[model samples]
Target: MRMKHLAIVAALVLGLTSSAFAGQKIKIAGSTTILPIMQRVVEAYMKANPDVEIAVSGGGSSNGIKALLDGTTDIAMASRTMKDKEIKMAAEKGMNPKQVVIALDAVIPIVNKSNPVNDLTIDQLQAIYAGKVTNWKEVGGKDEGIVVVSRDTSSGTYETWSHFVMGKTRVFPGALLQASSGAVLQAVAKNPRAISYDGIGYVDNSVKPLTVNGVEGNATTAKDKSFPVARTLQVYVDGSVSGAAKGLIDFILSPEGQNIVEEAGFIKL
Candidate 1:
């Protein structure tokens, strides 16, 4: 009888081990701005749930949404909400895209640390990007020509900057365009005359984040909507996601997952 009981226990242990090793693959692709946060979150989640496997990649927000519509990625991470046209496309394709807000982000205008200019009003920012204000001296900086570095048209960051700063005015045709937030940061960090913007999490000491309209962008301001460029970070899953996809989204919305957001330098929900 004792031998029989021991055999049953061993079988149970083996079954548990087998299930734990069975893989549930989840693919995430999207906004480079949210990439750092998701990377850390994926690391923690995978450690806690060894049965699940997750893959994450960044190709800008527009491409991420496109991947979801094409039935490629399980989750689409974005720094901006999906456009009406994108929703229409999803509807026509029989795809039900559900958005889950994960965090709050402040779009910060950054410049080289060596630059003396610290704060910029909305009007000043608009004029600078519009090619109306051509020199730094015009906006309280040194007597040097301003080099405008902007995100490419496909970027969600570019869309946010356009809505909040540019209004109807278009970016200067002469401006330099980068493909990602990291690229914009690098471009500005390497050029004293260059100015650009990015999500708050991507801002580092290499570049100085200027105060917009005398208000600093941070967790508090972003959360309260006091910052001029505050926006929500999100993930879009097709239809009603179940299994590992749902688990991952739930984990991101959990307290511990939100801690990861704060650690990643964004405002947690």
Candidate 2:
């Protein structure tokens, strides 16, 4: 009996050891928005291949890119396209940046639920950020001062918003610069006089999404090119990725991933 028990224990130990060494854990880092979607995909992959492990993190696009360059991360997630200089830097570093489009997110301009203003044209939005439009009454809202809220320069959302909405114009001095999309949503939701922008994923019942040039920002509008603020969510792969990393990307572009994107309040691309 003792000899038989020893044989069984030895076999189990060897099997466990072999399994541990069978596959490698894939390291990944991404933007906060991409984190959830990526996680869902990874979890699904793990169900089929239990030997693989995936690690994810978020420190904004720049930070994700930095991690890839510095070898701290294997995958970089971005909400916006890489800048020309970043692509050049990757080349200089002997790293190839592989871009995979995952989803579409509208840079939804939101206002306090109490604010009656609902519609805005491109020029009017440009004026508001450029300090030209100061009163809500000018755009058919309440006869109150227009309080501008915005994201800081470090935010990729701000970069896109400034480019598409401001048209290379500046977001006038004293505009409230929140840190993240959630913060922007919160500020706009609570302050009746406030107006700010966010990722479509952040839109909810608490705040109201404005119609830009009379175009609504739903998945349909984004797909039809009517959502003026719609932007692509991207995943950047540095060097060759393991099956795990590739699987995560594939999932984001898959039906399940798109479902998660839609459930998160963003548009599925």
Candidate 3:
């Protein structure tokens, strides 16, 4: 009787261990813009719930959407809304992408600190990027030729800029394109004449952020919609989210998760 009792206890322990190890794991991939906020929130979530596992990555927003349609990632991060074409493509693949707005963001234009230009009107910005105004002197800056830096076409930041600043016009062909927001910051900071745009969270002492039509890019301006370059930051889930995926999403929308967003230098929703 003693030996049979010990065997039952051992079996119970093994079953509990198996169940704990079987907890759901979620994978999130996309927008470099949303990477920092997601990282901090997920780190907190994992600590609070030890059984859940989450993986996060950044390869621009478009790639994140592609991952969702391909059935590779549980969540897709985006700085801009899904284009109609992307929605259609996902439908063709039988995948429905649902967006959850997690925060607000303002795309701030940045220039090297040494540059004297402080603000730019909408038309002036358009002319400069359209290749019509090639020299800084035209815009009350130095006499040197302007060094245009921009995000790659695949980037959601680029799409936002193109819509608001460029009026859907293409950036000048001569502009240099960077792969990520960090890359854009680095390129602009290193070159005195270089001008580029990045999320407000990415703004730091390395580069000077320019005012758009005299309105600064910040939480206040973004929330009031006074900032011309503001947009929503989102995470796209496949159909109805459940399990670990839903847990993470719920935590993000909670007050605790929104606090993480603010702590990461973004405007919390």
Clashing pairs in 1: none
**Candidate 2, 150-218: lDDT as tens digits:** 887766787788778987789999798886667778888889988888887777899998999999888
What number of backbone clashes does candidate 3 have, counting pairs of residues 3 or more apart or in separate chains?
A: 0
TM-scores for every predicted model? 0.92, 0.85, 0.91
> Which candidate, 1 or 2, has the higher lDDT?
1
Flag regions of model 3 displaced more than 4 Å: 1-22
lDDT of each: 0.93, 0.79, 0.91
Please give the clash total of every predicted structure, in order: 0, 0, 0
RMSD of each: 3.2, 5.3, 5.2
Give the distance in Å from residue 236's predicted Cα in candidate 3 to where it truly belongs: 0.3
- Lowest summed lDDT over 10 consecutive residues: which window, candidate 1? 14-23
Best by TM-score: 1
lDDT of 1: 0.93
